[model samples]
Target: MSASRYQDLVAKVDAKAKEFHERYAAQLQCKKGCSSCCQPGLTVFSVERLAIREWLNERPDLIEKLKAQPGNPKACSFLDDEGACQIYPVRPIICRTQGLPLSFKVNERTERDVCPLNFEKDDVLALPTDGVLNLDLLNTLLVLVDQVEGGSEAGQRFALNVDEVTRT
Candidate 1:
C-alpha cells in the first residue's frame, strides 16, 4: 500500500483509540509517566514494528541511541532511552487497550482486571455494556493491509514484523 493509505489507516486507528480512551477514562486510572508495561520481554505485533521503524527512520539519532543501550535485551524495538514508545501515535490496538476494563473469554469463563491505580477504588465499576471498544477499526486496518498482499493474512503479519519489508 502507498504511504498515503498507511497514513490514513493510522489516523483512523488513532482517532478510534482516542474515542475508546475517552469512553473508558473514568474506569481506567492510568496516569501519565506510568511505565509499568514498558518493562522488557514484551512481544509486539508486526503493525507496531512497522510504525516504530517509520518513526525511527525519521530520527536516526534515536535509533542509534536505542541500539546503544547497555544490557538491552532487544525485547521491544520501539523503546527509546527514556523507556517510551517511539511511535505512540501509531501504536497497535493492544497497546491502546493496555489498561482498560476488558473482558476476554478463557476456558469458557469470563475474566476482568482493573488497572493497578483503580484497583483500590470502590466506586469504579465495569459497565455491563458490550462491544463499546472500536475493535472493528483495528480489524479494518489489518484487512486493508491484507488486501495489499492479495488477501493473505500471513503477508500482512510479515510486513508488520518488518522482516519482509525493505524499508525496515
Candidate 2:
C-alpha cells in the first residue's frame, strides 16, 4: 500500500474508534487534561510514526517540548501543557483505543482489558460485549496495512520512545 492507502486505512480505523467512544461514553470519564494513560514506554509502528512525524512538522514547539520531557517511562510525547493530546486527531491505534473496555485473544485465550479508572475496578465484565473494542482485530488490520505499504510483516517500530519517531 502507498501512503495514500495507509491514510485511507487510518480513516477507517478512526471511524471505528469514534463509534467505540460514543458507545462507552456513559462509563468513560476520559476528557481533556487526563494524563493517567500518558505514561511512557511503547512500541510504535512505522506507519503511525510517519503520520505523527508529518503532523509534528508543522508544530516545532511540540517537538521541542516532547524532547524535553522524560522519555524513560514510555509516555506519549504529543501531550500539551494541560496533559491533553495536541495531536489527538491523528493519534496511533493504541492511543485511540485506550481508556475503553476492550478484549482480545491472546495465545488462544480471551483477555479483557479496561482502564483502571473507568468501570469501577474489575467491573469490565459488566460492559456489554458490543461496547468493547476488539483490539486483536484492529491490531491485525494495522499490521496488514503496514505490510501492504512495503514494511516488514512484523511491522517496523521504534521501541520505547515516541520522540525517536520525530527525529529527522
The TM-score values for the models, in the order shown, are 0.62, 0.81
Expressed as tens digits, the lDDT of each residue in 30-141 for candidate 2 is: 7788878876666677777777777777788877777786643444666766788777866777877778778999799988887787776447866677877788888887
Q: What is the lDDT of residue 99 in candidate 1?
A: 64
Candidate 2 has an lDDT of: 0.71
The positional error of residue 85 in candidate 1, measured at the CA in angstroms, is 2.7
TM-score of 2: 0.81
User: Per-residue lDDT of 1-168 in model 1, one digit per residue for the tens?
Assistant: 246545566666566557757776665556454546544454444544555566667777755665566544543445556666655665555666666555555586655554576536643334554434434445666556545532222344432222232243
**Which 10 consecutive residues of model 1 have the lowest summed lDDT?**
157-166
How much is 59 displaced in model 1, in angstroms? 1.7
Q: Candidate 2 — which residues are off by over 4 angstroms? A: 1-3, 69-74, 150-154, 160-162
Q: What lDDT does each candidate get?
A: 0.52, 0.71
Give residue 155's lDDT in candidate 2 (0 to 100): 72
